[model samples]
Target: MTDVHRAIGTHGFERLLHHLVQLRASQINRCAYCIKMHTQEARRDGETPERLDRLIVWEQVDDFSEREKAALAWTEALTVLDGKADLGALRARLRAHFTDQEIGVLTSIVAMINLWNRIQVSRH
Candidate 1:
């Protein structure tokens, strides 16, 4: 996944956005370890305390950008697949902000974090 991160970073995926996606997915999965890890990493990378604190209610809050919202929405849709996930619409929204390759990278990031979240959550 480090390779995926590097690849995505090359495509303009900033560190803060990466942490945001990881944090959002971890939150959806209720993975305390990942949530803590990503939140700390985000802060270490200069993410504002206000944004980090408000990330749980990102949709209702006006703190995130359209791109961040799209990524977070995609992360949630992918993480909490309750058979009603609107993948097409989510992909469309992602496309509005990211290129096809970037979308692929974003999907990979979400999938990776979900995998980690499951592992971490299952351990407890």
Candidate 2:
């Protein structure tokens, strides 16, 4: 997992978006530890209080860019997946804002955070 983290870092994925993705996944999983840690890291890295506060309701807010929205949607889809996901539509939206590599990286980010959240959640 540590090595996977290092590889994801090499993609130059936007920092704030990366934090938001982590927060969104953590939020879905209700992982308190990750929520606290990620929010703190986001702030330390120059993310605003308003943005952090609004992240959970990002779909209704204008604080995020379209690209960020696409990523967040993907994060949610991956984190809270049911049997009826419309992955093709999600892929279309993602293509409008990201490269195939970026989508892959975003997928990895969601998967990793969900895994971490499960581990943290299980311990509690």
Candidate 3:
């Protein structure tokens, strides 16, 4: 998964956005280790404190761009995967701002983070 992220990073997926996605998914999964790691990485990558603080409430905030919002929404939907989630609509939202390849990478990022989150959460 780190290799996948490295490859995607080389292919133009912004590092800040990648951290944001990982952070958001980690938050949803309640993985403290991931939250801490991603938050530090995001800060090191120059993400704003305010944005990181408000990430969990991204939908209600004005600090995020349309692209960031869309990505965050997609991350949440995939992380939760409850029966009530509207995956089709979420995919459409993601398509509005990201290419198919970008979407695939974003999906992988979310999936990988969720796997890590579960592993870390279960160990404690």
| Window of ten residues with lowest summed lDDT in model 3 | 1-10
Q: Which residue pairs collide, candidate 2?
A: none
lDDT of 2 by residue, 30-106 (tens): 99999999999999999999999999999999999999999999999999887799988989999999999999999
Candidate 1: tens digits of C-alpha lDDT, residues 9-119: 676667899999999888888889999899999999999999999999999999999999999998888888868777889889989999998888888888888888888
Angstrom error of the Cα, residue 116, model 1: value is 0.7
Which runs of model 2 end up more than 4 angstroms from their true locations? none
- TM per prediction: 0.90, 0.98, 0.93
- Candidate number achieving the greatest lDDT relative to the actual structure: 2
Against the correct fold, how does model 3 do in TM-score?
A: 0.93
Clashes of 3: 0
Candidate 2 vs candidate 3: the TM-score winner is 2
